[model samples]
Target: MMSFKRSRVIGAVSVAVVGVALSLLGSACKSDRAVFSAPEETFIAAEVDAGECAAQCSLDGRSVIRSCDGEVIETCAAHLACGGGACQAPCAAAAADRSSNGCEFFFQIPRYDPAKFDQSCAATFVVNTSLEPVEIALAYEGRKLDLSGALFRTNPGDATLIPHTGPIAPGESAILFLSDRDPEVAPPSPYDLYRGRIACPSGVVPALVGELPGGTRIASAMHLTTNVPVGLSMIYPFGGARSFLPSATLLLPVATWAKQNMIINGWEANATGPASQIYASEDDTEITILPKVDIQGSIGVKAARKNMPVTYRLDRGQLLQLVQREELSGSIVESTKPITTFGGHGCAFVPSSDLGPCDTLHQQIPSFDQWGSEYVGVGYRPRFGNEHEPMAYRIVAARDGTQLDYDPEIPPGAPTTLSRGEVAHFVRGTGDPIVIRTQDAEHPIYVGAYMSSCTEGFNKVSFEGAGDPEFVNVIPSGQYLNSYSFYSDPTYKDSSLVIVRAKTRGEFKDVWLECAGQNLTDFRPIGTRGEYEFTRVDLAKSGQAGQKFGDRVCRNGLQRLKSDGPFTATVWGWDYAASYAYPGGMALRKLVNTPLDPIR
Candidate 1:
């Protein structure tokens, strides 16, 4: 043997390992796509400082400053309390009075992008009260946003406070920052978003200075654009990128307005008789319909005239034909006669039924069942000249066994009674010999053949193959059986068999024979008799025909066998003759206990 290349073997092994690893990696990556984690927070408040506490705060590692006043703060409380130095008692009292002549102050805060940064975006504000500590609450419209550490200030320079922190006291301010970040939060659908609203805590509107805060409060809504990554496929929206706009214009009732004037008028078209019609102009691509027809009979009447057009676009000829066909076919089918089951077959007693009289008979007799039995309940039109001709009739016996006794006492006009064995005799008598093997017996018997000359002759013949076989001038029977007394005629050339067995073996012996005219000799074996199982027999060859042997042994259309070894028995044909003899050829059977690998 030649040695394999070392490099080739190494390459093949590496490829297989890599393939397996890639498959596992792909599956793991698919699972990770749906997973989301809460955003992390890194910024924390350091200080709060003095009077008119800073309304907004920004912090670096070492220090924090009031965003509003640019004042530095040492502690979170002082920074939150007042961005201006600690408020004078007189000034605080004056601010608390609300009617005092002091300047009004306002501040602004920026929102941070959570998708990119871990730092909290926050703001602080201050309020002064001369009396006891006042409970000032903080609220904003963007409360649904994932601002986890965000806080609010009651007074300037207050350290950022987590949500639900106690209400702020007089002269004290609170800072707002991102706090509890919920990763599962999903953007609301457009329909729900349009109807959504947010309210601020009592007495907590955006600050007003000298001028009044007059317009409707502005609510900040975000519109996101998600782009498919390069080299990745985008499915829905059919494009690589999708964009959304959170404009106030989308909130208008455009759909409702359009429906009222444009769509509704076009739909309510003219009605002539039972059908209503609508037309659409090229400029208006659509038309809506609101027919006032009665609902009960409307479908039928509409269906009748559905294709008729008030406009000239409809094809009159096609529409008329379709309407006529539909009405005619529906009416005819509804009035047609029904079929009734009789003698286990569907029989149509009336002429209105599409099928002829013999439909039931043909349906009841399956092809396989008709193979062994004559007068098999199958319907066939007899040829004119063949009407009076005698036909061979084959009958099956009950499993308990049938008696084939000759009844000599019947009137000459009465039909004869042939038993199971006599039927076999008649089948063999005709040129077309058939073999029948019963499971109750060990050997197969030859059934009689079709007699063109004598239809009654088959019935007269005894099951034991003895009798004054009367010959009727009929078809094949008189030509073959009359010449050969043994009823083994091979003239017509088509010989078939029907095997009826309780059970078949896995292995059967293949018996071979040598045929010479009416003489048969030298029975030999073909194939491994004990090695392969045989289940069926093929009489297409002269050697296999029992009539060639002058003994009609296997003509009952069946064969029973007894075997000692664990082998299947089947007889099959090889060429066209086999095809003709058994339309459905032999079946190969294997023992259930045999290893499935070999059979498969």
Candidate 2:
């Protein structure tokens, strides 16, 4: 856990007003740092602590009063100008507000301590649309390299001069092979968000390689950006102390970051147990962790347990790891500013004691603001059967006073007065994996599915002795996408399948896949979760090539999907070749009507 020196904001003494309780979240080093509190209700002018402040004045509209143990500081108005940077004035004091997304950004993923694993990293990037060829460059250890040749095919030919004609077209994908290494310094690791102006020359969206350097170990949580809407995922494979490997897709931009989130440990029944990791990225992030014991124990008729409000201020690139030997152990994490969260079991068992599919699993939890009451969770039914494979689903509430009416009634029914940072846990219960929005929409709820480990290959039923549970973001129908260009990992022997389901009755008017050249003829029903239908496309049957699914020259790039209306699609990869189960993942939704650029 690396730490940056905080740039404390000191100010001139001035008239002060009553203060509110200050919230504090922190760094790894607690000893040398001093803690202080804000002035109580009636605060007056006080001297500024020049070198003692730990926070810089916020430029974004995310400023919150930060405090140490217990000390009084300047007023909110004054703190805004303390960081020493020349930023616009606070919006409250202005006649009109003006804050918008920046054109350039470099996300910082927390670095993993090298001492931990046999270290290896693998990644791929997919630009969301077919746009003018954007010039892309790469920066590693301070050395800049031109990556446009391998990643982008422009009108001005490259060294090969083969007259570029790749998935450089709309709805297509490409691979980034990064073997370029420089001597100045290794890419910034752990906690530090590295964004070099020189790294991305043309200033195409902040992003990442070929032959990718051999010593590559993306141990830390990763941060990638694209000039256009793009998606990328990195995996820290199984290794020492980390037999349960974890891989996570980067969440969408801060424009969509939410303040309230319900932790959904997307795992299954009869597992070794709950090992949850809570991670948040972005500045001005303040999270309050409501442990499970506190929630369940606070049930009506039962005396409330003594659970203190423990909040953490998360810096970009930091992950708050909370692991415990408890059942579905979860927490309600609330943030002040827009922040992204990821929760998962460190290492879990599918059938509890079964060793084969027991691997690490995690997914970036979507903000409740984006969650929908209606969700259709498609469970995996291997071509061959694994009778006992089970799944668990949790409904997380984003706000208090949420009213929930289920299609398949949940026993005690959802709590009448669920508050922020609370959750209701339940299994598929003979009913389908769908949560129907009923009784209320004032506060949204997130429906998450957890699948147990399964057979590595079709009917290879001997239970490979160990399998890993997998978690996925069961996107809401409201967020269904009409078009997407995604790829399958060639590292495995089997190809993954894409599940596209209709969001509403007649929602999926028509469907098309690149493989067939026309509307899908095999569209089928997926349990009628809603008054709609769904269909699946098996890329394996399309054909296989040395580097992709199609033949040489006609190589299969990212699979393109276009439907009449909006629909949600998820991809599941089987770890058959790895002799283990790979927790499947969902594609970054590029839905219909989504803005090409986020509003400021």
Candidate 3:
């Protein structure tokens, strides 16, 4: 393991606070709303000597040698002269052995001298090559001996090591300097030496040597060296201490069990054990072991079991292990058959009606109140027309259910349209029965109708209507009023009409029109079309109407209508009948109490 340490510089005074403040101020200033103006543009040209250009110019710098069309030609120029061209440096010598089929070779060690032992002492090994740039790495593990060091390489004739920033180019050689200790301490031990090199276009094999306990030289221990082919797989063993159950039984396949124990690099203990159980094969290929745990006490002890089957591959006599553990917690045993065959089924509701005939009213009018009294619950069925093609038609309200005047001239097979007056009448329980139309022939054609109980004058009236009364009331008051006043009564004051905005088309589909009448105490919807009608008497004039009796009455009517638009006419004039007018057929025939005295 390598640890990196950094030195911190101490200051005579604490400047961090001021530094932070300055930093914040700088950021604020940069982000402030300020503008900067650039200086005027200027251009100039100059000449330099050819030798000066080659010496001072770098690949990244602007080396101007000529000018064309008012643009400077600053290329990687070797010379500044007008006709001078680029030049190349001489190449280095290649390796001596070029006939070898493989580019692999072993490292040559120099004789060691005890007199030369020093902390900074290092040995340099050079390898000459003609191959293109390649990568190289060195690794070693010294357990019996404590030799720890690093390696560095330098360019030829350079006193200092060349930072290994990039690869070495062709025809160039690399020097690997190895030191047992850092430049400041002397080595403390003499141990086995191992070194190797790998060049492009070929592979290299390393040589290994070890020393006995008594310091007896083990001459050229080449057999101990491991030569890994390019792209070869390697598995290093590792071991650690852990607590386990004493009676636990590990069931694993032969191959995976092999990785349980082995000496890793002849240094660290690679087997996880205290040695009660072990697994081994006749050949060195498979090896495994299950170390037993020594329990302090047998109180309430239970046996635990696990089984696992794993697979792995072996490359170049190296054992690669992969282990998967599957455990059984309780005594219960159950087996399941493997899933092999499968089938699927699906279903859909086959409605008997065509798209245009289905009871789409359910989607449009969710409640019975949405449709007036003319329609009951709606039913749909598909039918084939003359061409044998599917077509749907809506079942209109029963003949007895609709009123005599309940004939709506809606376009056949298309959505029905009603005038504001008609809509008001329907909502007021005095209009014609509801009708359904579908001219498009593609959309659903169902219409719903339900009876609405409303009080008309002194009697309770039953209105025969159709479809959703709620839908009839969903129109945005603003757009509805705007369109109504603009078309029906241009003189109508904008303020007299209260407008409402709708968020969706469904809400806008119905409009609620309300206007106070002399017979009503609250505003009420006009008809099924969301239209409200205010007679001239129902409207109130402005305050200036006080100048004249007619104006005063008109203003009073306007105020009453505007304030109580949703009430009945009779209720509206119940308190101020003297100021209003009524015909013999009017809902409010007469007023007992009058607010306005007989004109003088």
- Measured by TM-score, the strongest candidate is 2
Candidate 2 residue-wise lDDT, 1-600, digit = tens: 212233322121111111111211111111221121222322111233544433322212123233222232333443222222222232211101101111112322212222222223233344333122222344443346444443522110011112232334323345443322122355444432221101211222222332121111211233433443333333334111122343434334444455655566544333333434344445556666555554222111122222444565565644454433443333555666656555555455543545554545555565555556556655544323432344555666655566765544553434444555466655453123344563444456666655445543222244342223555666665555444444444332323344545632324456545444445655555443445465554433222421121321112224444443455555544443121222122322211222111111
Task: Arrange candidates by lDDT, descending.
Answer: 2, 1, 3
Residue-level lDDT of model 1, residues 372-423, one tens digit each, is 1111111011112222322343332321233232211222232233232122
lDDT of 2: 0.38
Clashes of each: 105, 34, 60
Which stretches in model 2 have alpha-carbon errors above 4 Å?
Answer: 1-117, 128-130, 135-170, 176-221, 238-250, 266-285, 293-306, 316-319, 324-330, 381-389, 398-438, 455-467, 503-507, 526-530, 541-557, 577-600
The local distance difference test score of each candidate is: 0.18, 0.38, 0.17
lDDT of 1 at 598: 11
TM-score of each: 0.13, 0.57, 0.16
| Cα lDDT tens digits for candidate 3, 1-600 | 212111110011000000000001000011221121111111111123332222111111122222111133433222121111111110100011001101222111111112211122222222212123333343233122111222233321122433333443322223333322322222344431211111111111111122211011111110011111000000000000000000000011111111212110100011111111111221232221111211111122222222221221122212111111111111011112100000000100012111110000000011111112222111111011111111112232211113222223432333243221111122211222223322221211113111111111112221111110000112111111111100011111211122222122222222212122112223223225433322222222221221122212222111111110111121011110011011100000111121111111
Better of 1 and 3 by lDDT: 1
Candidate 1 differs from the real structure by a C-alpha RMSD in angstroms, to one decimal, of 43.4
| Candidate with more favorable, higher TM-score: 2 or 3 | 2
User: What stretches of model 3 exceed 4 Å from their correct place?
Assistant: 1-102, 108-120, 125-128, 141-156, 182-215, 219-600
